[model samples]
Target chain A: MPTQRDGTPVSVLARQLRILDTFDAGTVFLSLSEIAERSGLPMTTTHRLVAELVEERMLERLPDRSYQLGLRLWELAARTPRAMGLREIAAPMVQFVQGQVRQHTQLGVEGGYDVVYLDRASAPNAVVNATIVGGRISLGASAIGHVLLSDKPRAFLAKIVEAGIRRYTDKTPQTLDELVDVVDRVRELGYSVADGFIHPAARGMAAPIYGPDGRVLAGLGMVVPSGEPVNMRIVELLRSAARRVSQQMRAAYIDPDHPHALPGAKFRVLINSSKSSMEYFEGNEGG
Target chain B: MPTQRDGTPVSVLARQLRILDTFDAGTVFLSLSEIAERSGLPMTTTHRLVAELVEERMLERLPDRSYQLGLRLWELAARTPRAMGLREIAAPMVQFVQGQVRQHTQLGVEGGYDVVYLDRASAPNAVVNATIVGGRISLGASAIGHVLLSDKPRAFLAKIVEAGIRRYTDKTPQTLDELVDVVDRVRELGYSVADGFIHPAARGMAAPIYGPDGRVLAGLGMVVPSGEPVNMRIVELLRSAARRVSQQMRAAYIDPDHPHALPGAKFRVLINSSKSSMEYFEGNEGG
Candidate 1:
């Protein structure tokens, strides 16, 4: 593959993306030196790429001269229909769950062997968890993962299982067989519970959210203290919230005039109120 | 500007970004032809680029072979600290205000000549709004804009004013002088109220959120029926919420062990319970 002047194993577009990939949940602001080191590019190459990104407003300068992801990138993240829409629809319900459960209530979707949390309401001073909005964790270590795994094809599940599962705690599903059995249970029950799978003290249960096509689109999970007994009421809460979100998701894919929308699913959450006055951002498009 | 192979006045990286930008809140899914048309790129170029983007998982292929913003992009968005953090900290309070006011309550930051909404809790089926998350609106048309404008330097305000304020309704500020007085009044009272500015039937009030350094960071605004009198209680609610978010914003920028977190500002909102197991996403970096 043709590479940048720095001789990275990709195109210039790939090189620029590598520079952006250096940032994650843990690392936000970075100096040029830090960027170069993390991206494994020469300082001169990093400098040029950083300058382009900054000019395009995909990355911005902090007061101290470090760089952080810019407002423009976040805005694109905002305009994203599925992820942002799902979060909006699930927001009120997530907050309600967090209030009742008082631990961590989250909405997540499957991405490869991990489940990506889309939105969450964190209860104050809760037990350690492995999930947050915009954060992802291994499917082998949480109820949400099991819920997502349940809907996957047997072949896909077998492939990931063959790849191997890393145990997060002593109780996390460690072997391929264990993962397969857990998936079966989740598929049967329409919910999954993983006690101390992520953190030793945290226990969680997740219910699958179905789209209008009746395909599992996401998972709604609640995490609490493992010492507490399994709360059936919370399980019911998860199912109800997931049902509402699922109905909403299906409607987004269907036309407003389409009669095929599930009869009970009212898109009451989606009423987008804006015509989007984004003339200021029409320019400076950068990858 | 080194152009793409098609002789467009931009780099290949820019072309790729334009492709991504084509999918916004309104346009989530598009066919190859639609992507080419919307991005203003040639058919062959769009075809080759779309294939590459799908390969990289930046754009996902729907079952019908149309493309939509993929999960990877949402995951990238999740790692963004500023936008994500601000939304997380302000989520609870936004819901609170929405519950009390039963209106569109939102958080916005000034971006160029407009205020970009960060997060919002829209009251069910509320009045028409001119902005949404990831959406922006003119500084002369709403209370949030006034609060954001209030803290801008005199020169910056003058430029937007000179550029011409487009009136959304007859009541929207149209002149530089009216804009100036609105800013002055907002500064004096530490809040702003606009009656039927953006929509004929909507009124709004906003308060500025300050940073640890006391710089205005964002605005918290609530929109209600234009006929309703200005509610002083909502103003009080906004100030307290803004104050809490301001303190949290300062803490994010401060050291973990720093003794000076303003006498009473604890990072109570940010006690995210996640250990963040994003290691699965750690390095299959694709451009």
Candidate 2:
């Protein structure tokens, strides 16, 4: 994407987006110079655009004259159907599950070859987890990620396997054969478990959330410190929660006002209940 | 901007965004007709674009053929600096407080005339709250919203007040003068208390978090049932957390790598933490 100083193929809107994208989980704010450098725009252009954006409230200038993502973007993004809708429905249920298990609970959706966390909740004293809400993990690495992968066609899985898995820890399954086995287990048991894979000290149990047509929509999982003997109790809890969520989804499907319904389709997928599906799936799967 | 049937001001990108924006805390998915109607685009265009977007994996089509915000946008937005970075720094602190308080804990930043929730953790059995993570609330309404307003100049407050306060419940403060008093008290107490303002059965306590220059960067709050008396212990915990966050902001400010520091500014205001100053000034003027 690099180009001669002024000949960059980047559109003005893309450049502006690039400037915004420069901020991420690691970097929340940046100086004008830093933004210019990261966006690879002329310092003058970056300054002018940044000023305009700030004026539009798309960027906020800190007391020190540093810039961060404007609340406007967040507000606009809040209107995004997928993130906010799923979050609203899943939140209370996630809270319920976290309360019961006192562990790190997360809701993730499949995106390409990875799983992106949309919502995550844990007790203050819960185990530390590598996944953060609004963060992504490889589909081959974490149990939740792999559960999403397992729901996809085998051809898709092969494509992902072809793309090397970056090992986060020694326990991350590196070989394609091992990954295939894991995927099979996820499909067979209707859940997946990763012990000390993503983070050396963390273990996770995850299951798929299905849409009305029985397609996997997302994955829900819980993380805890490693070395806890695998127990049926946790599995049962997660499965029950997942089942409850699925029922809610089915209810939404039958509701005439439900947005997911097609013009004449008999049901809606009910994205909101996906969290409950996660909980229910985990609970039943564990049992 | 509307145009003749032959030509429309709405660009392909804007239409694409509209499809995504149509999904919110309430609307998660929609059929082609709903998409076209809500976005004000023709069915042909909506169908074509939605199909293309689905191909790009930027939108997902369910078995019923309705569309939801594709995981792609969530993935990309996840990389957006504001959502990820602020949450990372704030999560641990929020988690700690939630552990101690066992109530609804939230982090929010001002977005235009509203507050965009970044992260929230609540006691599973805590009071039902209207606030949702990644949702928006009017600036003149909630405790967090007012905390942000407390940092703005008087002229800015006047503009907002003139714009009008959306009353969500009977207890919601309507007049600007009344709101000014609320802001004053928030400043005096180093925090804010919202009683049945946003939702009838809910109340909240919030404190501002500062950036490097001691400006209010964000607001952290908790929600509880309305009838329950204000818990001083939770207030103390929130205040302490806000203070420690302010210290972190200061450290970031002094560091050369801090985003807000200009090359050589003699004085800097932390944008997110200046609520105290604004509140103090307002109180002195008999706000």
Candidate 3:
């Protein structure tokens, strides 16, 4: 494998991507020297790559000469089917859930070992929500993650357990046994309830959303104030919202007249139901 | 300059970016051959780049073996201060405007020669809106652009005119003279009112949002059904929302307690008002 001046066994493209990856939620702006330090690239190489990235408009320079990720990345990412596509189809349902729940409503999809949020709708002065759009939460730490992981195989759950879960709170699952128990409950009940899994003052609940092929595609969930008796009405509402999103997803894939219908593809007419195939849920999650 | 097998003068990073850029709004999914054809790269080069991109999780392979822009791009773009940052700050004001106008409310920032929409809020069953988040509109064609350009220099408008504006409708500004007239009106009124500029059935109105430095940061606007008499009350609502967004933006930069306050930075306090400096608007729009 070829390497840049850093000898990191990375391709030129990977090196460029590495530079971009240096900017995250906390470190949105950085000087070239800070970028060199964070990316571990020599100043000359970082300077060159940063200049090319600026020219390509992937990284923009601030007025103070600091650098940040540019709008070009957002422009490209806006076309992503996994994020924006599902969000567009699920927005109305999420809004419905948010309006009824009067808290935070979110949609998340599986990304590696975490559930990445696709969209979120929150009421003013809602309960504490740590999730942001395009943000991620560990699979063993939230109800949304339980819904996403409910369809995964035992081996996948074992691997996540072996990798070690971050204990967000004492209520978070700490072992494969705990994870499997929660996932099984989600699969059997068609919904999940995680009270104080992340924060002691908030509760999380979610239901699995399915794609056109009857495979689990994402999770629709909410965060509300904890300490109250579990509201079965809200749980039913969440499941209904998830079902609506699933129905919309299926219609988009099966109905040729749908605006989001696949251009030249065929799919099975999946019915939006709480039941899905659990034995064959170990497939790749498509965008 | 190093060239690929297709004899393009693009560097490796540029080639990779070009491949990502091929997936746009209309073309989200593509096969390997389709990507090769669209990117104008040789099949082998396209294959190698696509494989690398998949490994990097920049492009995801769909279940049909086609490819789409991946969630990782969205993940990275989520960290961009220009798009998501501004969108987060301007969201509430946009929502307020949407509530009052009962139409498609939007916030846009200047990108290159176009105005890129950062965020939008629409009521259910609202009038037709062609703009999307992270989408772009020509700077000379809409009321939002007029507010953004109200502070721009005559030479900048001339350059846009020389580039040959696309006539979306007969009501769109066709020459430098017409563009200047509308922009001058916007400058005088602290708001813009464009009737049937983009679509013959809709009208556009916007006001300028200012930054901490008193520079025009964005345009807060709304799209409504045309053919009705202009409602100055709605125009006042739009200006108020823009002012609220500007005040929030200014507060975020100046208040040390603000969650989004810049660390280790100081600047002159800026007051948010309808009036702003118009003589010095010709400068780089920073992220």
| Candidate number achieving the greatest TM-score relative to the actual structure | 1
Question: What are the per-residue Cα lDDT tens digits for candidate 1 across B191-261?
Answer: 99898887677788898888666778789898777887788898899888888888767756645454432
TM agreement with the true structure for every prediction: 0.88, 0.69, 0.85
Worst 10 residues of 3 chain B by lDDT: B273-282
Best by DockQ: 1
Candidate 1 docking: what grade?
acceptable
Tens-digit lDDT string for candidate 2 (A1-287): 43456765344445555677666544566899988888888899888778766765567887888877665556555545556555545565666687788777888887667778887765546665766566677889988888788767777777777887878788887787878888899889888889988766678898667666687767778887788788778887777776666555555455565444334434433233223322332333312
Q: Which has the greatest lDDT?
A: 3
Clashing residue pairs, backbone N/CA/C < 3 A, model 3: none
TM-score for the A-chain in each candidate structure: 0.85, 0.83, 0.85
Cα lDDT tens digits for candidate 3, B21-62: 887665677899999998888899899999999988999997
lDDT of 2 by residue, B1-287 (tens): 33457554344445555666665544566788988887777789778778766765567887777766665555555544545445555666777787787767888987667788887776546665656567677878888887887778767777777878888788787877878888888878888999989767678889998877567888988877788788898888998998786675564344455443334322122212223322323333311
DockQ-sorted candidate list, best first: 1, 3, 2
Going through the candidates in order, their DockQ values are 0.35, 0.16, 0.26
* lDDT of each residue in A1-287, candidate 1, tens digit only: 45656568476667777888887665667788989998999899899989888876778887778787778777877756557877877888888889887778888887778888887777546666666577667777778888888877777777766766666677877777788888899988889988888777778889998866677878899878788777889999899988887876664565556443222222322333421222212221220
